[model samples]
Target: MTKPKALLIDVTKCIGCMACYYACKEANKLPETEKVEEDLSATNYTVVKETDGVFYRKLCMHCNEPTCASVCPVKAFEKTPEGPVIYHDKKCIGCRYCIQACPFDVPAYEWKSNKPLVKKCTMCAQRQKEGKITACAEACPTGATYFGDREELLAEARKRIQENPGQYINHIYGEKEVGGTSVLIISSIPFEKFGFRADLIEKPLSDLTWEIMSKIPNYVVVSGVFLYGIYWIINRRMELSEYNKSKNRDSSEDKN
Candidate 1:
């Protein structure tokens, strides 16, 4: 089997350049506005933010077991074997379930469109199929964002941390958080300082959702039986009332 691919982002190496941002916009065919929004939006698949002299890049993490894929009733989001969590817009029902289910809050809705679709990074699946890297990674001049096999990238990140202990924090963000993401980050400072959520557990978010969903069949069965009993009781009462009324009417007619 082919090894899954991944992206390793070293926050210390980033220069706060918007090359990856613009490259994402151009690659996704999004319109270039006069002014760029500093936050992630439908048009902006990736954004670079600088806080306290440290630059942090934000985009879809693409979990190994994606909660977005789990919560999507229409199965619009799919985690492909090749490594990308791809979205099929045609199958989407505009429910926004995936947006709510994501741990990183990555997916954004198109508020401007009459029929909006959830938008986020695809890890350049099409480009990968063509033996090319992601546009963002390709446009990165400083090589902050490195793309390769997931395991290989993990090894590289560990080596960098081990070799230069003073340069980066001991932990590799996204290494095990939410069951390991396709995108990994190694930062010099604490991740929480850069607006990254550090409260997430190591287990996959989808597991919790599946535990709840597993009870759905039981819920349906109990509800169905309860509703049927109510209907039956009402019908029986109505039939008894009609029979009593008919008997009274016959007695009156016979007396007349």
Candidate 2:
């Protein structure tokens, strides 16, 4: 099996350069923007933001067990063994369930298109298959974004925090959030300061989603039966009312 890959982002090393953002746009062939986008969108899969002079990148977390994959009724979202959460456009029903289910709010819908599809960073799955690093990591001149094996990246993150105690916060974001993700981050400032969610549970959200999804078939069956029973009762009552009316008219004719 291919060892899962990951990206380790050191927030301190980021230089507020939008190299990763531009490289992603070019690699994905998205439309070029004159100004850097402030948030993720259908066209902009990734964005870099500066908060209080600290630069940080925002993109898909690519959870090991993706909630997007679990909530997609058509199975449009897939968590590949290579560490990418890939979306299949053809399989997508445009239900936008993945958008609602994603905890990170990474998935973006092409709301302007007549035939819209959800979009997000793929973690450069094709580049990984070709034994090349992701476009973002490759374009990072400061080495702010480093890509490698998931386990190795985690070790590296811990080492950085240990060696430079004053430079890092000693917590690796994405390490245990939603059951660990392919992308990790270490920073001097707390992640909450960067708008990263601090309330995320360590358990995989897909596990909870499955618990509900497993009962969906039974729910549908029961609901169908209930609705049919109501229909049958209404139809039977209408038929009996017509029959009684006809019988009364016949009795009136015989008396006359």
Candidate 3:
């Protein structure tokens, strides 16, 4: 569908001011955590993560086959045709399974009260539907973040890496991870050094887990093995019992 996507984040310009976070909360009209300045709530869709000298803007990865969508028991999370993975709070049962299943750790739990909702970036779905840029992109002062088609973004990322080998970390974080995410990341320091979870696999995070438990003939294999073992044990016991009975009969006969 030539669906619109986003550029890989270049962390070079992010100064960790968190103007984007404030813009997001204001745009969404979300309440503050009030305990610390960084209290992420059900409404705070996008936030920032920082490490020694690098900063990351954490939000939904908008994965190709999102694990959150796949794991939602009632399907509260949905991937839009336009490429944004959006959440429907009304259908949500307040179950946080999506939080646990997400490898990127984007979704945040709203544990403050009853009727709390799990929240993460929607890729600014409402604005996109209305033909506008994402709030964070628009609010960014450094022109650091951008939005576009996923394919085009990856190409741009590659081009940048090729043009300036020493400038970037030479890795595009989300281009192929999780079956190709709509949101991409380009970093300055290595992503792991910047507090990104590097342990997540490149596959759709749910695929392997779902496969071993849901598909193939593992159950049949296990059942066959169990039955075979039981049968072997029973047969051995029967043979031993018969031998002992025969010995007793032979002894009695001999005695008589």
Full-model lDDT for every candidate? 0.92, 0.93, 0.80
Model 2 steric clash pairs: none
What are the clash counts of all predictions, listed in order?
Answer: 0, 0, 2
The superposed Cα distance between candidate 3 and the true structure at residue 180, in angstroms, equals: 2.1
Q: Which stretches of candidate 3 lie over 4 Å from their true place?
A: 32-36, 213-256
Flag the better candidate by TM-score, 1 or 3: 1
Pairs clashing in candidate 1?
none
- Model number with the top TM-score: 1
lDDT of 3 by residue, 99-208 (tens): 88788877887787677888888888898889887888888888667778777888988998889889888789987787778878887788887556777777887787
Q: What TM-scores do the predictions have? A: 0.85, 0.84, 0.78
Q: Model 1: how large is the Cα RMSD against the reference? A: 4.4
lDDT of 2 by residue, 41-81 (tens): 99999999988889999999999989899889899988999
Model 1: lDDT equals: 0.92
List, residue by residue over 9-55, the lDDT tens digit for candidate 1: 99999998889989889888887978876877888888899988998
